[model samples]
Target: MEMLTVLLVVIPLISAPITAIIANRYVAWLITLVTCLALAGLSGVVLHHVISGEVIHYELGGWKPPWGIEYVIDSLNALVAVIVAFIALITVIYGSKSAEKEIHDSQIHLFYAAFQLVILGLLGMALTGDIFNLFVFLEISSLSSYALIAMGQKRQALVASFNYLMAGTLGATFFLLGIGFLYAASGTLNMADIALRFDQFSSMTLVITALLFILIGLALKAAVFPLHSWLPEAYTQAPTMVTVFLASTSTKVAIYVLIRTLYQVFPNTYWEEMLLPGFLLLSGCLGMLYGSYKAIRQVSIKRLLAYSSVAQLGYMVVGVGLNNEAGLIAAIVHMFNHAITKAALFMAAGLVLMRLHTTNLEKLRGAGKTMPWTTGAFALAGLSLIGVPGTAGFISKWYLVQAALEKGNYVVAGTILIASIMAIMYVWKIIETLYFEGPDKLTVHKVGSGKEIVPDLPVATFCCYVMVATCFYFGLYTDIPLEAANTAVEVLFSTGGGQ
Candidate 1:
């Protein structure tokens, strides 16, 4: 079991270089597919073990306690690990064909290598018990993500990557500085140890400084409004596959870190005095409104979805800000729900782009008739995004509204409803384009062979079906994610067990 813990990180990291070395694209994709499947299986096993009231703790180099590096797998981290790995698995399957369409043949192997590395970093961040190790893994993922985003079509991709690099670096530096302060105050880097030692520093000003720095850094990384300038470009210009992975998992991992630092490492008494929940609530409300307003005016479909991400993240933060058990569970459930829904939507966008060679809404007239299954899948996912009942998105929104009502905050509940309406408007724009707009009548031209040649899209109706099935499956059942989220919240807020 202990060995299994390390394998989560080891398998992906080791497979990356081997995938890069393989010259044949088919072989490289095969390698990536196998590795992702293995990871998904391993993550499921770990989740099962953790949910059975077993926490897996593995110390590096046989060293234990506050000294050596450790990997901690409790119900909270294990559930998130499963989410991240599952997203990776689905994205890789979607990517196998999509990569051939968008990326050049020569770059295929490199793409897979970087893709696996990003997943490894996310898994590492989730499992590590040490704050410094978390920062290290965060950087590894951020840097690789920059490269992946830079590999897009527009010259603006370079500019987008550069901007993200600057922002991500500053965010990372702030996190490192915060870790430095914590180390200075407590002389320990392990999270559990820091929680244990935090009370000893009754008058520690550095802890407060550390708290602010870490919060700001994580907020920036998570693209929580006002610091979200870099996200639109990065998501719009990056390769579709990269956008899918980042949308589904990367920022969610950052939010997980925020949850860990605020609720797990710091004492609850500290937040009570600081009114942290109020501050979070304020920012979250602003982000939700601001992002939805911006999304309504976007001409590019991908850009619109990117803005929606900012709003969706706001929903998750609102749950955290409520500072109640129901609120926390709502936040966790939405995190998982948004990940799958966004990944499915983005995958569908990639398929459309492959056929049309563009993501501009104006150019996508009557795509529904031509690509019925793929467009239908997008519409379903879009409906989920709007929180229509009987979908995964509805489940999260239902809980969020319930939490707001529980707190007797009618204004917050109203805000959630209004924001969701805004989401419906933007989602409907794409749907309208696909179904109502008539296809342009253009002269057909044939090149190369006598066979009528159309753009070879990597994603087929089959890939779209897989994602749509997943959306409905989790949407209807609701037991697994809700249970896991409830357990995680209980573990996080239990007295004498950190915050």
Candidate 2:
């Protein structure tokens, strides 16, 4: 209990270099897997403690809060840490097989090591109660992600990696500048302490500027529209396994930072104002419509999914814009739902890419009959992405609608409905390419009922199935995310409680 928070950062931070020392790729992968398993277990335990109405605060170097670095676990951050670790655990398990196919044998060990660092950075960012510590971890994750993305088979990956580095560096800079402003104003780095002191400088120009800087910085990392130019290319050209991990973790952590900073460090009146709401709503609407539109026109299946992610991110932003309890819960739940669904979808993409050596929609025609399990996974995840009834996505949309109605924001509600319809269009195309399309493009034939052929990926199929099953499980048994999100909202907004 005393060491849980520090261990969350330490275990994986130490494991990365140790895993890199291994000569064998498979051995390195196993080491990384074990590391993720431990972290996942720890995250679950911490979440259990937090949900049981206990907060754990661990001070670094034997110093207490407001003077030394702190790691705090309340319902909000505990839930985020769990989601990050859970997705990372799944990615490490799922990526081991996919990495073997996508990356060079010589570089595979480094890939696994960098993968651990990325997970370490994300988990650390979520667990840290210090603003400056968050920035440090953010850099770690960003640096590791650049290396992983550069390991892609495509030459274009180098350019994508460079673009990401540039954007991420700028984002980190903005975040640091914001932190400097806050420190100047309050002379504290601890988040709880800063929150307590916010009132002292609420009317100062530096404080508002600090908030603006932080918001812009996080938006860049979160791939919010206008600043999201790096995401599509990065996702498209990165190794399939790398894409799965980044798609699941990176932006979600950025969103967590944004949520925490606003709710914990700023006054409610400032955060809930027209400027913030209007900015979020307008950007969300644009990204939702524009991203889905671009997705529909994409020839590459991976690129299609990439654009779809842009739209999915918009839904999360919209949930934040609503600024109500239901809206916040909608955003938090969607973060989990989207992370798992995107991870599964990307896993399905990896499976198809491994078999066909391509992710072109035309090249993958009729693959559903051959790799039925893999395609089934893709189809199911796609349904969740579309917010279909009884799927996790639907629950998020339902709450978003309820919030919109409660706020009397019919336009935003209608926009959400329209976005869901757009999701249907893109996802239907993926399904059609998988199933109804002919197998005229197949060059290699396998023994499957004597007619159609596909690659047998039982392990990948099983992993993907497990991901899809969670979509169904969470949809029907909504208590987990709902309860956690509601608790988070209550704690965050309760008078004097955010501190």
Candidate 3:
């Protein structure tokens, strides 16, 4: 069990270079599939142990904590790890066709290589106990993502990737400064060690500065509004598959880090003493309304969904700020629910992009009649996004409303309802364009035979169906994420930092 920690990171780390060296695109994709499968299985095992109330702590090279690096597996990180790997697995399976279509044949292997590194980085960030190591992993993911986005079919992808690189570098700088300030204050870099000694230097002004820097850095990475300028273009310009994978996993991981740092590394009292909770609540509320409003106005389906991600992220941030059990549960469970919901939505969009070669609202008119399976999947996932009953999105919003009301924050509660209404508007825009309008006959593709045919993506469509089912299944079940989130919150708030 203990070896599982190193294995999770190592498998992908070793495979990445090999996949890059392989010239065959098919071979590279196969390696990626196998790697993701292994990661998903290993992550599930880790989550299982964590859910059973067992924490796995592994010292690097037999070095003890406070003096050497460590990997700590608790419910919070374990669940996040599972989400990352499972999404990667499904994405690799769904992406083979999409990748072949959008990327130059020469660059496909390199793309898969970068994809593996992104996984490696995300998992490392979740498992490592040292703050500096977390930054290292962050760079791994960010650097790889930049390259991956740049490989998109459109020329604008290069510009979008460059912009993302600039934002990511700035965020990493802030994060590193925070780590330096923290080390100066606590005389340690290990998270558990820092937590244990945090109080001794909590009164120092440097500690407060560190916390602020860290918060800003993570908020930028998570694309909280006002710092999300890079996301819309990136998600819109990147290849269909790249957008789907990153949309599902990247910001969610950043939010998980924010949750862990606030609740575990520092203290819940920081929420009160520094008035951090109010700041978060305000930012989150603003982001929610602003993101949703922007989403409703986008003509490109991909960009519309990009703005929608900002809104969904706002919900998670709001829940975090509420600073109660219900709020924490809302935040954590929403991470899982939103990952699947958004992935399904993006998957459906990707299918349309693959078939029609465009995601423009005007071009995709009447896609529901021509591409029924994909359109149906999009509609179902959109319901979840709108918080309709019996869908995963509803579960997240319900908890959020409960948390807001519990705190007597009627305005925040009202903001949530309003955002859902805004979501419905944008979602209906796509639905109406796809179903109610007439097909753009001139844009439809035809073969030499002059016969119209819709291409089939059996595996990809199946993957989308699987994701859509999970959205409904988890919404109804509720226990899986709730149990993990409840235990994670308990551990985070416990004495001794659950170490």
The lDDT for every candidate, in the order shown, is 0.85, 0.85, 0.90
lDDT of candidate model 3 versus the reference: 0.90
lDDT of 3 by residue, 403-443 (tens): 99999999999999999999999999999999999744525
lDDT of 3 at 96: 89
Q: Which stretches in model 2 have alpha-carbon errors above 4 Å?
A: 444-455, 496-499
Residue 200, model 1: lDDT of: 92
Residue 442 local lDDT, model 1: 18
Ranking by TM-score: 3, 2, 1
**lDDT score for candidate 2 against the true structure:** 0.85
Query: Model 1, poorest ten-residue lDDT window?
Result: 442-451
Q: Which candidate is the best by TM-score?
A: 3
Best by lDDT: 3
Residues 391-421, model 2: lDDT tens digits: 8889999999898899999999999999899
